[model samples]
Target: MRLTFLGTGSAMPTGTRAQSGYLLRHGDETLLVDCGSGVLNALARTDVGYEGVDTVVLTHHHLDHVSDLAVLLKARWLAGETDLTVVGPPGTSDLVEETLAVHEYMQGRLDLTLRDRTTGTFDLAGFTIESMAVRHSMQCFAYRLQPADGGPSVVLSGDTEAFPELIEFADGAAVLVHDCSFPDDVDVSNHPTPTTLGEALAAAEAELGRVYLTHLYPHTEGRHEEMLASLADHYDGQVTFAEDGLTVRVED
Candidate 1:
């Protein structure tokens, strides 16, 4: 699977990093994970523009994550696409419904389908996805995806503090893109600091191929090296701070 980082910043927008969005493409199918405020513009920059994205999978209802849903749906509609499918946690349907409610102009312009996958495994965009609940401000989830045809697996830890269960869910995946929202000195909650994230990674020892820390806040502006150093003290692995528009491939 080829994954692209559309937006990597936190709720607060950095000029370089927009918000929380990621794109995964395999074969002819493209699945977008989380569409934040600036994600639609980012998507336009890719070969698969907003019109080419067949489906969008959201992790939660946070504004930073789903801000562009209406915009994307409208973009697809204007591009002459007839349908768009959205899959996410339990409240996904409600979220979409309310979105259309607010944006009354967007009611029924396109054929919209909503799927709530809160448990078990399901097939979406040619991948078998297993979801688990995560620690967050609201009903958030993390996803583990394996392409039906083959290749390595990828895990996405939506927006959560690093925890053992989330790490275990990511075990053995080729790539684990997690929520590292700030540096160690922030004293924040509902998001992991680099040290805490590193400690969790060490305790679980998932041995993932490469760990990309994303959802960065402005406080993490110039602290990438310091943050990596702190994380390396506990968990030694191939780690990087994901930047907007950076694409990563998951292969065996």
Candidate 2:
């Protein structure tokens, strides 16, 4: 499996980064996690086209994560590509319906499948997509996408305030793509700071193979090295700072 960071920035966009979006691909299947602004443009830069992305998994209803979803769907329909499935938290179906309703012209142009995910296991084209509720301002979830054939699994901790549930959800995963939004000193709610991440790692010390930090805020722009240093104090695994367009291959 290959994971690509389409955008690593937080709610706001910066010169070096876009918003929150990622692409996970294995063979012909491409699954999109979070479709923020400029995501379609970012996809154009990669080898995958928007039409090839059939599944979308959202972490939460934050605008930075789902803002450009409708735009992408409309563009795909205009480009003559159909068959789309979007799986997300509780409000997923409502969000899709509302988004399509606003763009009524593109409603009947494609087949859009919407799945409202809560806390349970779901099957998606031979892959097992498991979701666990996390502690966030709004209803949020962390996703673990595992191939039914027993391949490597990936856990994406959408946006949360480092909680025990996150540690449990990420245990034994090949890669944990978590939200490291702020610096160690900066305190923020509904987002994980480096200090909080360290505490969480220290508590469970799960055998997480690799850790990739994403959803960075502007406050963390010039302090990437410092953040890595802080997280490394607790996590002894491979630690990486997610950058726009950076891709990592997952192997068993």
RMSD, every candidate, angstroms = 1.0, 1.3
Model 2, poorest ten-residue lDDT window? 198-207
Residue-wise C-alpha lDDT for candidate 1, range 31-86, written one tens digit per residue: 89999889999999999999899799999989999999888988888999969999
User: Per-residue alpha-carbon lDDT of model 2 for 101-203, expressed as tens digits?
Assistant: 8866776787988988789998786578898888789998888998766789999998888866588778889999989899978857889888788778778
TM-score of 1: 0.97
**Clash totals, every prediction:** 0, 0
TM-score of each candidate structure, all chains considered together: 0.97, 0.95
Against the true structure, whose lDDT is highest? 1
| lDDT, each prediction | 0.90, 0.85
When summed lDDT is taken over every stretch of 10 residues in candidate 1, the lowest stretch is 101-110
Per-residue lDDT, model 2, residue 16, is 82
Number of residue pairs clashing in candidate 2, backbone atoms closer than 3 angstroms, sequence gap of 3 or more or interchain: 0
